[model samples]
Every structure is written in structure tokens, then in C-alpha cells.
Target chain A: MVPISYYLILSGILFACGVIGFLIKRNIITIFMSIELMLNGVNLSFVAFAAQWHHLSGQVFVFFVMVVAAAEASVGLAIIIAVFRTRETLNIDQVNLLKL
Target chain B: MLHLVLFLVFGAICVAGAVNLLAQNHPISSALSLVVVMASLAVEYLLLGAEFVAAVQVIVYAGAVMVLFVFVIMLLNAGAEERTQGSRVALVLGIPGVLAGGLLVAWVLVQRTNTPEVPLGALPGFPKTIGALLFHQFLLPFEVTSILVLIAIMGAVVLASRPEPKMKVPEKES
Candidate 1:
């Protein structure tokens, strides 16, 4: 039997992978892709819980989240493009002017 | 029997695509892998009997968001170059990554063995039920979240589309 916890654990693993990727990757696009991965991880958990509860609320929430993720992707990509134009480099290490 | 096969296939796809997303140096390749991962997740949602959720997964994530990723790649003129990889610190970090993944697998196995058999009763008219719940119970929060996302999107676009700085001529040496 495939328990819901199996899905939840998968979600957790995906989330951890996303976090590690976000922290370790130096590329701007890669970081945002990691963010997307993290979002997907959460969506999986939400759907799993929705199925477990026998309610559609969790799935509906996933719908909302997906919508938000879409908007975030568009705007985030636009900003990344803008940054690339200004800096001519996509390397996060090189963009450390934001850091003190 | 069929369900098991489908699950194995999609699960393998998700895992392999995720590994590719992270392991590949090219951002476009990673983005494509992410699409593969999202498609499989949508399949999982469909298998769970959440047709609406599955549709949202495909339409919003795989279709729209991934297109945005592709757009960024095109606009930036990104090429496959050597990714900054391998230092003492990165390798040190890899240890914890492996441990975390192993621990997660163990926990899942334990929990799966222990979970009781619970039959999920279906809610009639899934979409309508969800609609009622959102409108009646979570109406305020729902609208608020939408507004917040809208504001963030607008702000990002406005900031991103700002005028470029003009090139300045250097002053002549005395």
C-alpha cells in the first residue's frame, strides 16, 4: 500500500534538494528554478494531504499556488533578464554588490 | 497492477528529472528537466483523482511558468559554460545532502509500514465543493492572497522595465 506519508517524504526530499540547490548554485536562473522546485514540492504535499482528507480544499489551494507561481515566474524572469542586461553576467557570485 | 506500473514510471521520471535539473550546468537543460518533473507530478495528481489539480499543474506550472523560464533563457542569451563547481565547502555540503535523503527514505519506509488502511470516501462534485469552501470559509484570505500576488507581480514588472542607463563620455584629460 502506498501511504500518504510516502508522498510527504518525497515532498520533503524535493524541498531539501531545492534548498540545497538554492544555496549552492551560483547561477541566477538556477536559483529561481530551485525556487520552482521548492514550490512543486509543496504542491505535492498539498495534493497528498487533500487526497488523505478526502477533501478538495488542499487541491484547490494547490491551484491557487500554481497561479501564484506562474505570476512569480513571469516577474522573476523579467527581473533576471533586466539584471542580465545591466550586469552582462548571470553569475550570482559576481552580483555580490548587493552584499556588504 | 497497472497503477503500480504507472506509479513506478512517473516516480522514476520525477527522480531522474530532478537529478538532471540539479546536475546539469545549462540553465535551459535544467528548465527542461523541471518541465519533465512537473509533468510527472501532474500525472501523480491525476492518479490521485484530483483532476482539477492535475490540470492546474499542467497549465500553470508546466505550460506558463516553464515558458517564462524559456523566455528568460532566450532573452539572456545563455550558453552552456562551465558552472562554478567543486570546492572544499561544496563537497562538505554534499555529505549532509546525502544523509538527509537517506533519512527521508528510511522514514518513509517506516511510516508506510505503519499507516493504517483508511478508505477515502469521495466528495460529490469535487469542484463545486471546493468552490463553496473557498467562498464561504476562506473567502477573505483567498482574495487577500490574490491581491498580494498581483501586487508583487506588478512591482516586479515595473522594476524590471525601468530605463537603461545611458553611456557617458569620459572627460578629456587636461
Candidate 2:
């Protein structure tokens, strides 16, 4: 038997890594990937809680989250394509049009 | 014992893939690392007995989403972005902040709580069961998400399409 806390800890570590990547990475695509990573961590947490409490709704929610993630990935990638076309760069710092 | 071993191994792989995603300089490599992370996460889900979710994680996330990311990277011809001064400063500050926050949460969850240990296959997440749940109890949300996916498809097509070239006007006769 594994302590549920271990699962939670792993999830937290993954989420922390994602946050670090999101903050430190300059590329837009990489940052988007980090967002996905963060979402994954949350998904794991949801499942762990589901297991703890024996609730199917938590698992059901994971499905909804996945649906949203898929939709987000499609739209986000399209937006990324548009941004790349105009700015000709993927660096977040350089893409700052409203920085001033 | 076996359950614990499997859980620890996959969890380590998941963490390694995540770290590699951050360490990789190129977007393609990072995208691949994310795929690895997602795959390992599916295994983790399976361990928790969410078999359907595990399969979906592998298919939808590792398969479709990562492929989409790779395709976009190739299409954009995105090169490795140079590390800027702002990124350096962010790395210096953000790493510690994230670490502290994560540690605090883990400490609270682990040390403070008296939560019981979970055995393997805590709950069966069969496809039939989940499907029923989705179509019955969560019916409205499921239908709404389908519409959302439809809109996303249209939006992606519109946004990614190149603008049509302008028509050439005839030159005026002298």
C-alpha cells in the first residue's frame, strides 16, 4: 500500500517543475507545453483524491479536463501559428507588443 | 509490494520526463519529453485503477496533443530561442519560489494529514462505467463539450489559414 500523500507530493513536484518551465522558458511553444504539464499535475491530483474517497465523479472530471485540454491545444496552437507569422519569432520577450 | 515498486518507478519516470522537458533547448525535444511525461502519467493512472482514463491519457494526450505540438513546431520552423536577460532573472527567482511552494504543499499534505494508504486498484474505472456516468449524470456537460470541440475545430482552421493573396489590378493604358 502506498500513502496517498506520496501521489500528492509527486503531483506537486510536477506542477512546480511546470511553473518553473513556464516562467523561465522564453519560447512560446515551450511555455504552452508547460501549461499542459501543469494541467497534467492537476489531473493526477484529481485522480488521487478520487481513489482516496471512492468517488467516480473525480474520474469523470478528468475526462472533462481532457476534453478542455484537447480543445485548448487546438486553438492555442493556431494562435501560436498566427503569432509566429506576424512576429517571425517564438521568443516570449520579443513577442511583447503591449510591453510599453 | 509490487504495486509500490511500479508506482515509484513510473513516478520517477514521470518526474524525469518533466525535468527533461524543462532542460531541453529545442522545442521539438521539449515536445517529445512532454510525450514521455504523458505516457508515464497514463501508467500512473492505470495504477490508480482509472483504466479508461489511462487509455485516454495515452491516446488523446500523448498521441494527439503531442503530435499537434510537433506539427506546429515543424510548420513554424521554430528554432531554439536564445535565453534572454529576462529569462535569466526569472529562472533565478522563479525556481526558488516554485520549490518553496511545492515543498510547503507536500509538507502539509504528507506530515500533517493522517490519510490512509491506498491499495492497488482502489476503484475500477472501466470504460462501460465511465461511459454511463458521462452520458447519464454528466450528460449536459458532455454534449456542451462536443459543441466546444466543434468550435475549436473551426477556430483553428480560421486562425491557421493563410490570408488570401490580393488580386492584381490591371495597369492603366497610356
Candidate 3:
């Protein structure tokens, strides 16, 4: 048997990496990927907690989260494509202006 | 014993993939690393006995979402990252801060809560059980999310599609 804290710790580590990636990455798409990483980390936590409690709701919540993530990814990538169309660059630093 | 070893191994894979995602310069590389991370996460979910969630994680995340990310990267031909002053500062400051925060959280959780130990395949989250939960108790949210997905699809189409060309008006003769 593995301690529940172990899973939670791993999840925390993943979330921290995501935060670090979001902060340090220059590319907009890479930052977006970091958001996905954060979501994955949270999903892991949810499932871990569910297993610890022996409740199905947590797993159900993960399902809802996955649905939302799928929708968000589709819309977010489209927005990214649109931004690239206007800015002609993927670097977040260059996209400072609201109107170009 | 074997469960702990498997868990640790996959946990290491998850961390490695996430770190690789951070280390890689190009968006495509990061996207691939994210895929690796997600696949391993699916495995972890399976070990937790959330079988349905694991399958969805594999199919939706690894299959659909990553594909979308990779397709966009290819379409845009996104290049490697360039060093910027802001990024440099973030790299210097963010890593230690994040590491500290993670460690603190882990320590707190380990110390404060005597969370129970979970064996492999502890709580089998079968599809049938999940399906019943979705259709019965969570029915409203499920429908709402379907509508949300529809709206997202429409929004993506509108945002990504090219603008329509203006039509020429005929001049009136006196």
C-alpha cells in the first residue's frame, strides 16, 4: 500500500513544474501547454483523493474536468492560431500590444 | 511492495516528462512532452482504480487534445524560444519559489493529515458506475457541458475562420 501523501506529493510536484513552465516559457503555446499540465496535476490530485475516500464523485469530477479541458483546448488553440495570424509571432513578449 | 515500486516508477516518468516539457525550447517538443506526461498520468489513474477516468484521460487528453496542440504547432511552424529579460528573471526566480512551495505543501500534507494508504486497484471506477452518476445525479451539469462544448465549437470556428469579403454595390443611374 502506498501512502496517499505520496500521490499528493507527486501531484504537487507536477503542478509546480507547470507553474514554473508557465512563468519561464516565452512561447505562448508553451505557456498554454503549462496550463494543461497544471490541469493534469489537479486531476491527479482529485483521483488520489477519490481513491483515499472511496468515493466515485471525485472520479466523476475528473470526467467533467476532462470535458471542460477538451473544450478549452479547442477554443484556446483556435485563439492561438488567430493571434499568430495577426501578430506573425508566437513569442509572448512580442504580443504586448492590444491593437496592432 | 510491487505496487509501491510501480507507482514510484510511473511517478518518476511523470516528473521527467513535465521537466522535459519545461526544458524543451520548441513548442512541438513541449507538446510532445505534455503527451508523455498525460499518458503516464493515465497509467497513474489506472493504478488508483479510476479505470474510466484513465481511459478518458488516454483518449481525450493524449489522443485528441495533444493532437490539436501538435497540429497547431505544425500549422504555425512555431520555432524555438528566444531568450528574453523577463524569461531570464522568471527562470531565476520561479524555479526556487515553485520548488519551495511544492515542498512546503507536501510537507504539510504529510505531517497534518494521516491520509489512508491506497492499494493498487483500490476503488474500481467502472464506466457503468460513472455513467449512472453522470445521467442521474449530475445530469444537469452534463447537459450544460454539452452546450458549453457546442458554444466552444462555434466560437472556435468564428474566431479562426477568415473574414468574409465585402460585396460590390451597383451604382444607381439617374
Compute the lDDT of residue A47 as modeled in candidate 3: 95
Per residue, candidate 2 scores C-alpha lDDT tens digits across B96-121 of: 87778877897788675677788898
Model 1, docking class? acceptable
Q: Compare candidates 1 and 3 on lDDT and give the better one.
A: 3
lDDT of 3 by residue, B97-141 (tens): 887887789779968577788889989999999999999999999
Tens-place lDDT per residue, model 1, A4-92, is 66567667767777877776777889889999999999998888777777767787788678767877877778778778877888887
Indicate the residue-level lDDT of B109 in model 3. Answer: 91
Off by over 4 Å in 3: B87-100
TM-score of the second chain, each candidate in turn, equals: 0.78, 0.88, 0.90
**How much DockQ does model 2 earn?**
0.79
| TM-score against native, each model | 0.83, 0.92, 0.94
After superposition, the stretches of candidate 2 with alpha carbons farther than 4 Å from their true spots are A98-100, B87-100, B167-174
Q: How close is candidate 2 to the true structure, as a TM-score?
A: 0.92
- Model 3 chain B: weakest 10-residue lDDT segment is B85-94
Task: Kindly report which residue stretches of model 1 are placed more than 4 angstroms away from their true locations once superposed.
Answer: B85-105, B108-112, B116-125, B164-174
lDDT of 3 at B97: 81
From the highest DockQ down, the ranking of the candidates is 3, 2, 1
